[model samples]
Target: MHDSSVFLIEFGAIILGLGLLGRLAGRLRFSPIPLYLLAGLAFGEGGLYPLGTSEEFVAIGAEIGVVLLLLMLGLEYTASDLVSNLKTQYPAGLVDAALNALPGAAMALLLGWGPVAAVVLAGVTWISSSGVIAKVLGDLGRLGNRETPVILSILVLEDLSMAVYLPIITALLAGVGLAAGSLTLAVALGVAGLVLLIAVRYGRHISRFVSSDDSEKLLLVVLGLTLLVAGIAQKLQVSAAVGAFLVGIALSGEVAEGAHHLLAPLRDLFAAVFFVFFGLHTDPSSIPPVLLPALALAFVTTLTKIATGYWAAKRAGISARGRWRAGGTLVARGEFSIVIAGLAVTAGIEPSLGPLATAYVLILVILGPLTARYTEPLARRLTRRPRPEQPLAPPAQATPVDDQDTVGRT
Candidate 1:
């Protein structure tokens, strides 16, 4: 067979398979991410039917997938929204970092992976998938709940934090000197602040500059601009994903909406490819050895995330049930986790990190929805058990649940 023919067949099969997996996940009311990852494993280096001709193409698609994921995420918030959430929710963000990130870092140290791997692992655990959480909230019809804002505020903080965090990891993974890494960090912070300033003050101008009546033109311009910025950011050692996100933030109004509509399909395609690419590089055989550790990590982090959400919601004066729901909703970790681990895996920082991350993510992403739906109910049920010894008190008047500040549904 000609190499071109082989490439066409291989890539076509992968796409078709991803579409089917996505449909299956939809029918099951679950995220398609785990299925995509599993498919990648089935076609990976140590698994069945590895591709010979299309791996390079897949790798390129995967990089674009990461950029698109971050870009779309940034589009979900305006600069004003970010500032508001930051003011109201900085404490939750702090607790989130302390609870979820610390465990991963501790695990890395326990495994003797050193400081760089520890930093990378901390990030892998720190971020919850905004993509997954948003879907679950919509599916569960809890978007209008009082605690929803609390959940979103934390997610926004995480997304913004990546603008700074990605550069630090990049420098560490590349084994740059302290001075060079400090310079890179400074540049990243400066860029992030400048972009935020531009987004807040000149977002309308940017949108107008990028806007087009023609759909094709709009798509082309937005995609081209994202890739160009991403490339330059990578050249500057500032992380391509951050550049793409900043671009997304800088655009507003009609341009942001049009770009989102035009780019969503591409984002889905590339994001699926990105997950597959992560799975493709991981040796399936390596996963078994790490499965127990991954399960343990997932369990511990799940509890920590719940605590983070609960504390944040309680602080916001949400109802008990809403607080539990908020905690449960934030338990899933998806795209960002893989992206973080993928970087370290590519750098050969630790051989076991990839497989461990794969196993951990698989457990949590699947578990995330269940927790979101049932956490409040389960907590209620447990507390409602009748005590045999105490005399039953007269039932108190039922208090009306007032979910105030119920704005921002879409």
Candidate 2:
């Protein structure tokens, strides 16, 4: 068969699988992410068909997906919203990061992986899928409720932390077995910091130009800025997603409504390609032995997130039920985890660990939405009943009706 023919056949199969499996996932009340992974597994190296493309292409597609995802995330918030919600959001964010990372790191070490790998794994698992959580809450009609803002804020902070976390971990992984000078680290940090500043400072200005009456101009400018920042971040050894996210964040406030209008279609189009390519790259043969261990890790990671998030919410004076809901809602890890694992692989990490990482992602992507769905009822069950109302006093007499009666008597 011709290479083109083979490629076309694989591509067609992937599309068919995604459409079929997506519906199946919805019917089963599962998240689409897992379905995408399943589709990938079915059509990948071990499956009935293989596209035989280079991993580089898959990676590129995934990278584009991350950028668009982040861009959409940024479009959801304004700078003001971020500042206002920081108090409630920051604590939960910290707790989420710590709980996931600490245990993950320990598990990796116990599994004979080194500190760097463990740390990277921990960092990766720390992020909850904001997209999944938001959708769940929205479906439950909880968008404007008290917990909504808090959860949203935490997700935003997580996104920011990840932007910084990626480069640091990447550098650490790259510098393994060698001394990384302070100069190199400083340069990386400085470059990232400067880029962030420019994005935020100039974002509003760029937004005004893009939000003008012309749709084509709006799209061109936005795409241009996105690509430019992505390029700069890559050149500086930082993940382009980080740059893309910052640009989105900067434009977030100014372009809140307009950005959405322009980018929504683009986001969906690119995101589809990203997921399709992601599925195309999986090597299913690598999954079996690591499956059980991956499941165990997923269980542990989810439980820890619940516990920590509950405690954090409780500390913030949330009701017991609210705490439970928060915990459950925060359980699912997503894109960030995969990115971290990919970085590990690039750093010459052990091949055995790769399957474990993929399995963990696959499991969470499948279970995250299901877990999120049940959070509300569970929260209600665990919350305390409302206190009884106090009795009211009897009504007081009006000036004995004295004056009116006396005047009317005549």
lDDT digits (tens) for residues 246-330 of candidate 1:
9988888888898899899999999999999999999899999999889989999999999999999999888788889999999
> Pick by TM-score: which candidate is best?
1
lDDT of 2 by residue, 1-410 (tens): 34666556655655566677767866875557766766666666677665564344555666777787777776776555555555456777777777788877887888888888787878767888776677667666656544455566667878777666877776677673334434444655676566556555676775675666676777777778887887887677676777777667677554567767878867755565565555555577878977887888899888987786677767766766566667777787766676667667656675656567778877877677666667657657666588777698578667542222111222
Tell me, what's the RMSD of every candidate? Answer: 2.4, 8.9
Deviation of model 1 at 400, angstroms:
4.4
| lDDT measured at residue 323 in model 2 versus the true structure, 0 to 100 | 65
* CA-lDDT, candidates in order: 0.93, 0.68
Best by lDDT: 1
